[model samples]
Target: MFSEDPGARIEEVFRRIQEERMAGLPFINPALSVAAVGFARHGADWRGVLLTPWGIQLLLLPAVADWPVPPLLTRAFRQYPAGTFAFLPNHEKELGDYLACPLISDMHPFADQQTALATARACLIALDIPPVRSEAQPAAPASDGRRRFLGLDG
Candidate 1:
């Protein structure tokens, strides 16, 4: 169910989580979901992103993580572990739309094909992945005539 390609893995994870959310499953941490979006956009480098319930709750509120904990709190409550959060990266501009109005309440933010495809394209662009032209010719002729019959000659 997994792929060796980093981009493919990230995309798969994002789609699976989206499906679970749409089905009303009690899976996917909000922070993880957002982080997954970032990974799906940015690729393998951001795979380490994660979000604890406490961390997300604190971030949503007006209160700062240090307000109560100070030095006593060993962990950085607002800060995600390493690459767990996507907002920390420089690709904020590419993801600003999604980040600004995320599906904080909606279960299937990415269930819409248009939204998912656009987001994936944005991610690939952010990661400098070149777009493959659908009109590009195949290197060899197909042995089967189905493609020609279907008029998908390219």
Candidate 2:
């Protein structure tokens, strides 16, 4: 109901929760945590979140600089294992470059350990190797004609 009438939807949700609270109901926390992070030698934090229907119960706090202790975001960041992390603007090249850096712990957004490992492996592979000669290797074509005279390859 957040489309045509956002106020009504918010009111309804609040009213339902209020009723549930009055009845001493338990809220099933509905949300999923997806993370996009940037990292440096020193620190990092989550850039965005992945949410599920139940997980939306999370009322996120502002960044730590502005917010008080016991912040929701603090808890979320803490939930992640201590290691590489950051909140970056969405850009694959930049993220890939960051991933390639040697100091990063390199675990990324995948829920599966293997998948995260794969990203690290891929990044490392990219950095360690030269680009493949996709356009065919440069050859001494008997002359530096730049372009073959009507393609002498025939």
Candidate 3:
């Protein structure tokens, strides 16, 4: 299992999902949700790279306004002028060091939650991340006498 290698596991997950997608299988929601959770969980390890409905946002924790821009961000800016959130890692006098700052200067609003999630998923694909199997759905509600206490017995 790729889980054994935390660093590479994320990529493996994205690759599998992308492969399945190319094969013409129906797209699944939970698969992308899992990817989002993974990104949320491990984003810091990847230099705070983040996905949003509008585009990618590089969150600079303990912000440095004058942070040196990386080539990846420069390209992202060109590709998504209103979408790239950028902050180059630098040490020339700390700026905006008190808070985490979004790098994108402009953004297009998502139509809704679903749209945002879908875009996030696409961003993962664009970035070459693989998806993993979905987690088990929550258990069904109990159907015993206790239902009356919860007002569901009506």
Candidate 4:
């Protein structure tokens, strides 16, 4: 529904959740607040990071109108530049259908909001990097390179 600015809408929705449901929870970090980071159009979806007191997640919200909502509690896989990741389907009354790939499930490790925000941004950067592929190398003979490299051949 928020085709123009889905990130702002997401922040608002989670802010409400923070106030109504997450307050005083033991696992939530008090220093962190709800935020949407690096949101931009990605094909037919808006991709970004959602930072909250409880966790940090990579969010994918539909950009098109009338996008179908997947069944709740089901996992969906989406491909990013980094790699394919599993996202959980969820719907918010205000935010509508979206997918979330949790990057950090515990916020307690972060000392402050800035540190958490930095981590969220770093995650976005990491997601943009393509996964590395290594070529296989032939194994060296045990008595040859292995012993020589260790200077034990003599």
The models' CA-based lDDT, in order, is: 0.28, 0.26, 0.32, 0.78
Give candidate 2's total backbone clashes.
Answer: 9
Q: In candidate 1, which residue ranges exceed 4 Å CA deviation?
A: 1-4, 24-154
Range of the 10 consecutive residues with the lowest summed lDDT in candidate 3: 91-100
Give the best candidate by lDDT.
Answer: 4
Ranking by lDDT: 4, 3, 1, 2
| TM-scores, all models, native as reference | 0.22, 0.20, 0.26, 0.83
Candidate 3 stretches with Cα past 4 Å from truth are 1-37, 40-44, 47-55, 58-87, 90-106, 129-154
- lDDT computed for candidate 4: 0.78
| TM-score leader | 4
TM match of model 2 to true structure: 0.20
The worst-scoring run of ten residues by lDDT in candidate 1 lies at 53-62
Candidate 2 weakest ten by summed lDDT: 94-103
Query: For residue 107, what is the lDDT in candidate 1?
Result: 28
Per-residue CA lDDT of candidate 4, range 23-138, in tens? 89999999889999999887777889999999988898898887556788887776656556777898888877899877777888889989988888988887767544357744
How high a TM-score does candidate 3 get?
A: 0.26
lDDT of 3: 0.32
